[model samples]
Target chain A: MPSRQRLWPIHVILAVGAAAMVAPFLWQLITSLQTTGETTSVPPHFLPSWQWSNYSQVFHDTKFAQQFLNSVSQTVIRVLAQVLFCSMAAYAFARLRFPGRNALFMLMLAVLMVPSQVYLLPQYQLVQNMGLLNTLAGVVLPGLFSAFGTFMLRQFFMSLPNEVEEAARLDGAGTFRIFWSVMLPLAKPGLISMGVLTVLWSWNDLLWPLVVVNDDSKMPLTVGLSTLQGEHLTEYPLLMAGSLLASLPMILVFLAAQRRITEGIALTGTK
Target chain B: MFRKALVLAGVGALALAATGCSSSKSASSGQADSGPVTLTYGIWDAKQKPAMQEIADAFHTAHPNITIDIQLTPNADYWTKLQTAAASGTAPDVFWMNTPRVGLYAGQHQLLSLSDKPGFDNSPFPKALNDSYTLDGKQYGMPKDFDTVGLWFNKKLFDAAGVKYPTAGWTWQDVISAAQKLNDPSKGVWGIASPDWTQENLFNTMLQAGGQAITPDHKKSGFDDPKSLAGLQYALDFITKYHVSPTAQQMTDTQPDQLFASGKVAMFADGDYDMPEYKAAAGLDADVAPLPAGPDGKKATVINGLANVIYAKTKHPQAAWEFVQYLGSKEANEIQAKTGTVIPAYNGLSATWVASTPQYHLQSFIDQLDVAVPYPVSKNTAAWTTPMQTTLDQIWGGKVDLTTGAKQIAAQMNAELAKE
Candidate 1:
């Protein structure tokens, strides 16, 4: 067994780090239960009076259920698309013998260099021209492809043993068949990490949704919760309650995938 | 590192917002269209949203064929979205228009001219407010609600200091003396808090001194004028020279409203928009009085109001105009007033608003309306205001002489105004 004395310093450091991350969330939780008068008070209140009604108010007042569904739908569509399309593109860049392979791979990498914002307008225009504005499809389409996912998956596919693909080819299997059946199973960690990340990102996206979707009924949780903030006076209690409600699904997602997330980190050594 | 990534993302979003704007301009406006239209009415204030919803429901009750869908973008993102939408010629059919931006929007021909619309009236609201939306002698929107600056004070703090509450005719000298008597630093109490905000603090003082924010013709800034500089000095002295007010650093750490609510500050300059929040503050008794007269012996406060404007490119102009007419009508104003959400622009309804919340004498806001000067705006106010605000930040921080900062800001503003 490890000695308690030897673990003390490490324990203290981890505790401090954990508390630093958790304190803001705890404050949010406590603030969510306080009265607007109590929350906005000077010498800010630490203890919650446990007003259960703030949560109720969020449901009754705002379109919380509709927005929550929008967030879930958008995230689910984005994650599935990223895992499927990114893997297909990554496989082409990794093992397929196509002409101009180097040039195409280089072009894909160059896209990673350009900021994501450069595509916002053009993508928006494409969506607009397609007459998808203020629709669920508009929120999902731009998020369908991701450069980072392609790059990460391509590297992971490349890192896999070459012998497996050659053996599949020797068995008279086609390239697409080899990627789908043989190589994809080995690249699970990379796909899982990319999927996890895409879920987190698409769930929290605010600006793009606000730009394209003007209707509140169609907005995701991120954009919907923003309207809780007032012009001169923000009611912090209501804001916290709305945010807490919106973020609960994300928290559940992280918790359920906790072991896989850690495994992904171990294999990839990166987020 | 995370902050850098977020900044990069923000920059990307701004680029997207810009491109998103021009790409959609092809969705052009048409001549008066009608029938079963769903009018999207955008507003910024969530506090006033419920009242707006009530107004929308009432409009739907009358105009059975048209449906009013209320869209809310929080105040910060409201303008960015509006600007991009306006640029793309897809702005909401009718939206809340603020004073500073309406002029710019109107000048670009993005807003419909309300004067020509049938059954539209601007006569019920204050003329100063109506004139705020009028550009080149044509009204583009009908005024909704008006706000004027007043001195918000903590009665308990004044009582503890044995100082009398501020009265209607209080001058700058009276405020200064009272603040001096109320200051107690050892107790962590300040006589007053003077934040470097335009609407809440400095803008009213500038007007009280008979100064303007910009030239009437929108060609030049007034910061270089002697009267305007003096007005700015009066506001700055509360922090730089006097011991009565909290230092700039302290006010930055804590908002002036919080300072007052906490009992650390005895007084602050704010508008009636803050009334609900003040009423909600625990252990606080707050009331407002007219902004003190300036050294020039005239009391003027900035009178800015919200207006409802129709999108220039709207396919359903008739429905949008009908909604705007309903918004300006007395019934809607009364609903807005009864909520105590704002001082309704309609003259008689303001008394109902004053009576809506009687705990604090909100009548001070109404009394100041008589001497209310329109908040200064040029054809492109944001163009000049952005540069002036950046320069004024240094002056407010006491990093440069007020005069030098004023002149520098004036030069930048003049250069920008010349572009328009």
Candidate 2:
């Protein structure tokens, strides 16, 4: 155990830092319950007007329920695809003895270096050409494969002890068997880390969905909440309320899986 | 093998569903299909959304076979979304367009040519706006509404200082004299908020000084001209020399409108669009008046407006055109005008809009229309304007002299103009 007084100062510093991070979110919650006039008041009003109707207005003014469904379906499908596809690719690079394996892996690593915007047009074209525009699958298609996840999982797989793979090979286990059954169970932390990131990225993804879907029914929450923001003026109270409700699922997801998330974070420190 | 067959069946079903969707990709455009058709109309203004929705409902009642879906992507993201969607041929069937972006969109053939359409009419709109929307000899959009800049002052602050309310005949000299008396730092109030903006601030003043933002030819910038440099300086002098306006840093931290709403600024040079919002501001008493005359004894205001345009690649071009025509129709403008939502672009609808909000003397916007200068643009305004804005920012921050900054902008803008 550490000395109480020595650790006490460090604890105080961390607590303050934690509060700083939480303050904005707390302010968002308070602002969501405020009136339009109260929210914009100078010298800053701390107490809210308790205008709870702001939350109801978001539902009434926009197709928030449908958008919430779209976000969920897209994110779940995207996360499942990333986990399954990335783990397989990472396993192949880690354990397989295929021709051009090193070259293929390097090319994927290069994909991570170039900015994502460079591929936005081309990716959109490919999805559009597939006749998936305005469909839920269109938004999920591009996010399904991620180079960062493959690289992170590959590094984790490489760091694992070689004895397990050698033992499995001696028992005449095939590469698929080793990857899916033997090594996969051990890569749980890496998979969890990738899953958490994919969910976060896909849930909040706005630009791709905004471009792909024109109908209000198929839009994600980020795009739906955007309607509350107009050209000249915005109703801040309504926007804050819509966003708070839209962000609740993600917040709950992060809190419920926080311990596993922290442990997953430890395995592959890079996001 | 049985499980494999099941998996294959699932994949086959997905492929069929994809084909079903792709086949209907032309459904929004092609009248040959004869089924119920839906068209997407994209817009950016949140304040005008309810009225736009009402217009759409009215249109739907008349054209029962056609359904219009409204998509609002705030102005900030509207273009980026449009560009991406246009590249993939999935842009909204009809959308709102402004002057600067009109040239870019039309040049890329992203917008439909409205002139050749059967019922297309530009006679109702101002000739300047109609010509502004034309690019490469093709008219692209129909004007939806227009807005002009005005001097919006806090009546309470004017009364507190025992100063007379601004009249239409007021000059720039009158503004400086009144601002000096109204500026009270001890009470956290500034006389004006003169942020370095093109539309509502510097550009209009430049025209008042007999200077154009870009030459009529659109091949070069007019900022390097002596008269234009003086116009830019006059707006900046309120902060640097007169000390009556908020500093550039403060204006950046707090928008001019926010300061005005809080009763911290006596005057803010804003557009006609903010009239409705000002009416809703609790404690602040505000009204509009024409911009003061410049040294040249001339008054000018920057006139800009949104237009309703159709995507060139829309599957339902005929339906989309009907909706666009209706949006610019007198009936649709009346619905928007009666609510004081916007100054309808139609010729005779201004009076109704003026009466809708009787409290504010919004006729100042109409009264200045004779002296309104068209919002400047070229085939690629962003290419020049983006850099021009940055160079102007340096002057605003006191890093460069106003004349030197304008010259720098002219050099960069001229180079960008040559490329187009």
| TM-scores (chain A) of the candidates | 0.93, 0.96
Go through the candidates in order and give each one's DockQ: 0.54, 0.39
What is model 2's interface RMSD? 8.5
lDDT, residue A40, model 1: 66
Which lDDT values do the candidates have, in the order given?
0.82, 0.83
- List ranges where model 2 is wrong by over 4 Å: B1-36
Clashes of each: 0, 5
Local accuracy of candidate 2 as per-residue lDDT tens digits, A46-136 = 9997989999999998899999999999999999999999999998898788999999999999998998756777788898899988898
Q: What is the TM-score of each candidate against the true structure?
A: 0.93, 0.93
Q: What is the TM-score of chain B in candidate 1?
A: 0.92
| Residue-level lDDT tens digits of model 2 in B95-174 | 99888777766766677788878878888887677878888788999899998999999999999989899989988888
**Model 1: chain A TM-score against the true structure:** 0.93
Candidate 1 docking class: medium
